[model samples]
Target: MLITEKKHGIRFAQRMSDLGTETAFVVLAKARQLESQGRTIVHLEIGEPDFETPAHIVDEAVRALKAGATHYGPSPGLPEARQAIARYVSETRRVPVDFERVVITPGAKPIMFYTILALVDEGDEVIYPNPGFPIYESVIRFVGGRPVPIQLHEENDFRLDVGELLDLVTDRTKLIIINSPQNPTGSILTAEDLEAVGRLALDRDIYILADEIYSRIIYEGDFTSILHVVPEAMDQVILLDGMSKTFAMTGWRLGWGVMQPTLAAAVAKLQTNSNSCTATFSQMVIPPALFGPQGPVEAMRAEFQRRRDAIVAGLNRIDRITCRKPAGAFYVFPNTSRLGVDSQTLADRMLQEAGVAALSGTAFGRFGEGYLRFSYANSIENIKLGLERVEAFVAKL
Candidate 1:
């Protein structure tokens, strides 16, 4: 019966067996492994910005290091960083933020983990968007919460359907997750949608977690945060945002969650007990990144929009590929079922044979079965080359 028959074995917690993962990382690892063997992989799989963190933000971190700011810091982050974040959030989201309620983490991940662990108890229903971030479902299941998915679709322009979403909400739902400029599909939830969700959350006494990490990356119209519409959402209304997407600082591992005082305290305590705190030098860069000159941010956004246009147009030009121009974020989800291969097989064939890396729609959820998420977070040159390879690959199929 193998090694386990000996009973000298070690085993993981039952919950460990139930956990899911972000397939992006798995694809990234495969891409890296292929690259190590001298393969020229055109990466369109990962969501990280190809841009560097602004020099100003980098300078601040250097300054902090030179100033001997390295040490264990406050669990809720430095006062200065929190205050700067407060101003930044208040200005961008059009909502007043309490600095005391902000908890900075090593990355945006722990904020999700802590919030889910703190709020979701066994068997409670949690509503998250299908064809959305994999982590939301993973966290819910890890906590033993019943994950209820709201199916997103291309016909509705991938807009969050309030009626469809609320229909899934029962008295048992403890949390509802909303992500705009969303991952994989890059679909957005409108202000009206947010307002409806806010009303439902308030009426049902459900907590809301809005992941607005890509708020600054909008291509069309104005960007709306949950703050702009969900102020009255009953559950402390945790808002997660950070430097990773907006500032192209994913490697920095800096992000935060804004919440009400009570919940913030629990998160801070979680930070103290578990994470302790984020890096001091990283925390020190917030003011510069937030209150600095707006030129770099604007320039990067315009470039991303240009790339978005190129990729969407290019993908649509490929026979049997249908892509909707996303309103925000740096991804375009294309329906590839017309090619007569499942998304996972298509992704693998493209990566291994064509040297183009992308994520399968099934990586997100069952609703994403016929799609593939192509990230435009690369240069126009690379994006075009990758699509050319994809086009050639599809032609063969």
Candidate 2:
């Protein structure tokens, strides 16, 4: 009321306009709105795992809380948590990782945000996979960096071409981001693909941010990490991973980054300025989640594989819509271009008419046009029901 009483308006920073958002949350709100009006929505719009967090993780959090783990921890993270993550990554990737290089955060997005802030100068170019995570471009632009997109073509099975990526690099290139098993398209980068990018980073002295959050959810073959593929480039690589995807602990808001110690120090300083530290009790669960029995993780992965098969088959059976079986992650990027409208319109229609909530491909990037992303993180019954509704909607078209 005080501000409204004045004739002048408050001004937001110009950078606010440059920041984009994850469209899944927007669709989620609309889906919830429709549900309030008595419609049943089969939600595949959001990427969160539908399963509960395994009990052991929750038990650790409760135990820690009871033991007075609620106080503020170090800005970088609790030392024990970082050490645990280091050991876990070392054993899995087969590349020795120093605990000193790991920095924990409230969630993985903070790592992404802090990284761009730490490395990118104004007007510097950052190459990232288009139709990848929207936050990658959003943070880059927010920090006044030029976003150079390396398109991931569906024909190439949505994998980034190393030659194409290198073509986009210039004197201004400072950072390159690669996500795999990637978001939206759900494509895993091959060992050969990882090696090519790693070698390029080594030669050009560019930093690579490898988003390996879904590394534990692969359907075929052992998951390959960039650190394993090119151990020499370890100093130049920043790994973004967390318990969110693997442990179904998205709401726990716990994640960490592994990078060169110097950069980790800088990112840790940024963490100090921003979130202070991830919640103490949340950080307490990291050790057990990483070292405990991995059965729950494997169970979820197996279930996701089953759901992936069901959704891909059901989507392909629909007239004019074809979906690729994703090698990892819980999403399926289905081509809906054969229909008359663009991605957003189809997505809107799917929600309004069919009560099936999903995201437009363009939500990820412009290259995402003519496609739509659906997270198969829902149940088989919901996936089947959503597919049926979408089939009916398409038939009416």
Candidate 3:
């Protein structure tokens, strides 16, 4: 094989240069490398659950495949799957969404990207949480929108301050992204905060992108949705969720977006130009995942709670390490400022010296500079060992 450079001056979009990336997969690759070299690495990097997909859900998918439900269904989604999602949202979250307004996609990420592309324009502004999901910023920049961050601080339990968020919004602000039981920090937005955001969205005539992917994974109080507080805002709000986090079906590549009919049609057009539609068999399994027995989801939540307790308690015991007990999701964002080093240095030292894999909080955004994110998706035993390794590493510092 010969390697040669392109002869012509190949032009690329300038926006591509400003795009960012998610670092969880990068850390996961490094962890696998260490494991291959005979190092026993306990992975707490990626935010995936340790549970298998519920038996009934898997069986449903198999049944669909065997029944020859493998042809391309619809550009938006199979009508049945869309209706199931509409019912699930209405019954579970008390969010009234019409079936015609739902567009199913391969995963939540694609919906997010499409939403950014639809609302963002050159020099427009998009607001998102700092130390949050990196893709929010990545896609915003990919669409040539200026990313304005809503800084979620540890003092505030990583919750978005409504007033501060509103202050950042201006006439050019096209979209605001909100994530509850958020990635990395695992902080849930309070009902009051949601109401405040909804009111602002209504008053400002700005669009809201509510990411409820982890809505069902809460360990504390009831899960809330922005759509519940301001139903009229539904016309301007886009809700993105799926079976990935709730049903432990991440690899199945299934998710759906809820928006107004016009916005849904626009996203559907984008989907038609891009992926066409989610896999037919996967769409066939969504109804069972949403309406079937929910015991497996509850069991997964309980296990995550156990691991969360173990890791939080263990980190608190370790010197020069401080971790807040996350109220939802499967991550613990701990302040490593007491260690007198940045998050990246601490993460590197932990991976290289202790053979433990965790993400540098800074990888999410600059607001995460002095923190590290530990995903509690593994077993209790592995969490214990990982904490032990972290303790040893911190002690040496």
Tens-place lDDT per residue, model 2, 284-394, is 999989999899999999999999999999999999999999999999999999998999999999999999999999999999999999999999999999999999999
Query: Residue 8 CA error for candidate 3 (Å)?
Result: 8.4
| Pairs of residues clashing in candidate 3 | none
* lDDT of each residue in 1-397, candidate 1, tens digit only: 7865786656778989779999989999999999999999999999999998888888889999999998999999999999999888888877777798788998788888999988999999989988999999998999899999999989988877888987898889999998898887777888888899888888888899989888899988999877788766624588898989888999999999999889999999988999799999999998888888878889999999999999999999999999999989888899998999999999999999999999999899899999999888999999999989999999999
Where does candidate 3 stray beyond 4 Å?
A: 1-12
lDDT of each structure? Answer: 0.89, 0.94, 0.90
Residue 323 lDDT (model 1): 93
| lDDT (Cα, tens digit) per residue for candidate 3, span 106-174 | 988898999998888988999999999999999988888899999999999999988799789889988
Comparing 2 with 3 on lDDT, the higher-scoring candidate is 2
Flag clash pairs in model 2: none
What's the candidate order when arranged by decreasing TM-score?
A: 2, 3, 1
Candidate 3 lDDT at 29 equals 92
TM-score of each model, paired residue for residue: 0.96, 0.99, 0.97
